[model samples]
Target chain A: MKARFIVSPVLCIGCRTCELACAFAHAIDGKLGKSRIYPIDGGFKELWVPVTCLQCEEAACVKSCLVNALQRNPETGAVELNQEKCVKCMACVAACPFGCSLLDEQHELVVKCDLCGGDPACARFCPTKALEYKPIKGSPKKIAV
Target chain B: MIRITINGKVTQASEGETLLKVIRREGIDIPALCHHEAVEPYGACRLCMVEITKEEWNGWSKYVTSCLYPVEPGLIVKTHSTKVIEMRKTIVDLYLARHPNCAEIQQLADEYGVTKTSYQTVVDGDNCILCGICTRICDEMGFHAISMVGRGHGKVVAPPLDEAPANCTGCLACAQNCPTHFIEFEDKGNSRTIWGKKFEMITCEKCGKTTITKEFADYLAEHRELPREYFNICDECHRRSTALDMGRIASWSKEVK
Candidate 1:
């Protein structure tokens, strides 16, 4: 059985604890760096949507990279970006369908969700049961939302 | 004293002490989930796994859970090897799969750099990580109020038959020792409710703090040998009145002069 990350909109409480946890986890030393997951507030109604790398099976970022720095890990099924091979051209950023790819200002490198090498900090830090990881017995299914 | 090298630094350890204790004593970082100072080491959560190299040991080097593994002489311990970190991350990933709402588990996942999981969600609205700290502490206190029930994804920290145990004395020991604060306790004016069981509360005579339950007060006065007069006032009122009495005595002496 293959594993997958699932997000539940009904369980989220709009706390944004997941974003803070993600930023701190990926931080260098004690300073909080870029967060891989971003939360979008839906205003006074309290509708908050958290966005991150979708880990698309047919990742558009992989095809758009001119330097071939973006590659997929077979074990984790995550699209990883190699900073050394990256030319900082921003082609992957434009090609990303979900707008998950970004240019890290401090490191001067493009960053995307690598699933933290098969363990995600965002799913771990969510205050509510909004995000989850588990195994699937049948064919692969992406979340409809 | 047994000597072991941790991260290239020579450190002394008493015989039978776990590697986690020795490494923490020398101020080294090793993340652990199930380890508590008061309870016995169960090693259910394998987050404290570390790589060890010993001369007399069979295969040159191997990985072991530090909380359960005892320290031996001439053992070279590496707290964070590439392999150890990877294992720690996977353990956290499994925890996240079961307990997505748990802040403590998620924080550990964040520190280990696991921002996502390949696994699907097993249980929804889950929070407990099954560390057994609450249940173990309850047993240690001799209350035996709650125990882990069910199996696998259905397991939960609940009282017998999902109703508050008749033997439960309404002590907040389980709540105080709980790392995640999963157990809910609501204090009303004259009563306190824990897991749907309500008990009469003890009110301080001097001040109106209703936090202490009558059963706990009696237990402390009888078993712990605490003076009953000490409970006459709330903790804040006791401090305040003591200071006022001291000030009055000082003023009386000043007036005499």
Candidate 2:
């Protein structure tokens, strides 16, 4: 199945509720109220782009992992990193042109959006409807002129 | 074994091997300085890049530093496509801007035929090449004595200014292992100079003619931990010095006998 997340930057309020919700969902306790949200390194809350993985057809992170740790989930259409298999090489981190992959606190592994198993918490939590997670029907085929 | 199409050519690689390694093993060369077989691929250089062909809708996308890329069955990879080459050239050019005079780097530039750097050399800056090789070597290999400082455009390799170590082992490992040859050393009579400027001097040991720079001699002596007398002059002058020492030894032997 092919899936895509559409981001409407125009509608984004820059409130960072999506970020907070993302962190909250991924938090150990899964409690938005009590969970401590860490700031995204090298970024500010004001310059927020309601970020969700593009799930690019040509995922650079999946291609760059030396340990065979990153793979495209054929089922979800999300690029996933197998943390146990990962060598913490940071190849995926550098290979990503979008600067989407972030180094985990250990500085070994990379952490990126996994689309939260299809029901994206970021999209659900967004008040401005900035994020839309939808299943794309068939592959986006180009017209042959 | 897994089959994949690289540059539209069918190739086979181990099931778990990275795409970078598979391509390299096939003799399709990709530039990567930070990658080493002994350690995990760092991917900081952004040099081993390739374009992977997805379905037609996405067309193509650029991926930098293929060292970590895993190969998948039926995966299509283009190591030298137009976009990949252009991005690699730009990255290499940026590295050149930080180290304009390194011979090794110049050679890579020549390979890509990069005549001009992407950006101007930072005013009055020392050699850096911006490859992150030094920082990686220190942290991964030497395990001490240095790290990267600052961030983004202001980033540089150095120890923290206020708390930098003084007893720097003078290992020369960082300099010797540097890909760009940006770090350098020069020993004068009393002191040693550690900077990035190039020095040329050649002196004849026998005739006392300046064959190469005195600075080169000093660099050798400092790095090798040799006495200044070893590099006092060029080869000719050194022969003369050795002959004089032999004569003194002969005289002393005769006197002792």
Candidate 3:
């Protein structure tokens, strides 16, 4: 089974290293990449929280795509955006309930997490054990003594 | 299954599908400016014209806008023919004469091999091809903010009474979808101006970044049945909270091989 990210905001130190790593990994031509994962300050101001595409089985971005540009990757089980097929409709941005789908302002294209072809940079570069790339069945039920 | 002949190749298509869709599925290229799957087909640009006939029509065939024409059994479609190209060239020529300043019209004219127009040029023509895609998308979005106003040559897109649209939630759907890129709007920091109206943007309470307009957030919250408090946090914080609710992160990384 393909793995997914399991983030722990409680353990997060909010260094934003994952954001940098994610953007760097996805960056092209030495330009600053549009990072898919964003670690933002939670309402309390002290405890920071990270936010990103949940890679839902039923994603709004997939449904909202007018040209079938966004589709599920069978190998990664992640929603991938077909940049060429997109017509810059911006429907997915408005349709996303959680607002995970982002419009790259410079490129005029909608962007989201693609699981980095099964190995996410944000999870790999996470200094703290906050972000974990685990299988859908990664967390097994255990009996507490 | 319906049998349709596209470019002399027999193809199978569903009964309800349009001829242009079937032709496109057969790997045929037909230029269309107003055709988008998100909205109903409106043959405004008059670009997708094709020669269509049937086996029973003998040696007679007629040109039809393929975007608006539906496929039928035993239908024969010619996507690109001498007569069809002539018809499209005429359309492009007329468009070029009317919209000499529009880059897209110029491009279309170039593709059709018509660099100049034979008709009288409109000295002060605007870029709006007026395909109605913007109004259609806005209607589909449930915001009847703008529509085609005026009559004949004076026709243009505007809000009611040429004033700021109260229904506009500062969504850029219309501006972004315009094929000619005619619609214009501006976003500066936490404020957005569009259609002569200004909107106060909703900044993410967590990251302090401007997200969307407060009017849009309120509309979304009410329509989606989400709590008003959720809109205050923004997507990042909500995603963070969702992760937190998904439970604990295990110690599997520390395990020895």
User: Across residues A1-145, which tens digit of lDDT does each residue of candidate 2 receive?
Assistant: 5556666543556677777777677664443331111212113222234434566677655654434566777777778766545544344443454445555453334567777777777778778775776667655563111
Pull out the clashing pairs in model 3. none
Could you give the interface RMSD of each candidate, to one decimal? 28.8, 28.0, 5.9
Model 1 agreement with the true structure over A1-145: per-residue lDDT tens digits:
1567776544567688877877777777777767766655423234445567768777756765534678888877888987645544344553453557765677555688887777778888887867766665565664434
Report the lDDT tens digits of candidate 2 across residue range B85-162: 888899879878876776766777898989889698755656675566555554543335567778987887776572
What lDDT score belongs to each candidate, Candidate 1 first? Answer: 0.70, 0.59, 0.78
When candidate 1 is compared with the true two-chain complex, its DockQ is: 0.01
* Model 2 chain B weakest lDDT span, ten residues long: B234-243
For candidate 3, lDDT tens digit of each residue in B1-257? 99988888999998789988888878888789887766778999989999999989998999888888988999888888999999999999999999999998888898999989999999998989889988887787788999999989999999999999989988787887788999989989899999999999877778877766888767766764545665576555556665443322322222321
Where does candidate 2 stray beyond 4 Å?
A1-145, B54-62, B118-123, B162-171, B185-257
- Candidate 3 lDDT over A1-145, as tens digits, reads 3565677666677899888987888776787667888776654434556777877676766765545778889888788887645656444564565667777776566788888889988888898877888766544443111
Writing each residue's lDDT as its tens digit, candidate 1 over B1-257 gives 99999999998899999999898888888887667665678787888899999867875799999999999899999998898888888888987887788888778889988897657856666666777877876675566888999998688888999886876768665665565667788877778899779998756566666535666555555554444454455533443443344344434544556
**Chain A TM-score, prediction 1:** 0.86
Backbone clash count, each prediction separately = 16, 20, 0
In the order shown, what is each candidate's alpha-carbon RMSD? 25.0, 29.0, 6.3
DockQ (Cα-based) for each candidate: 0.01, 0.01, 0.17
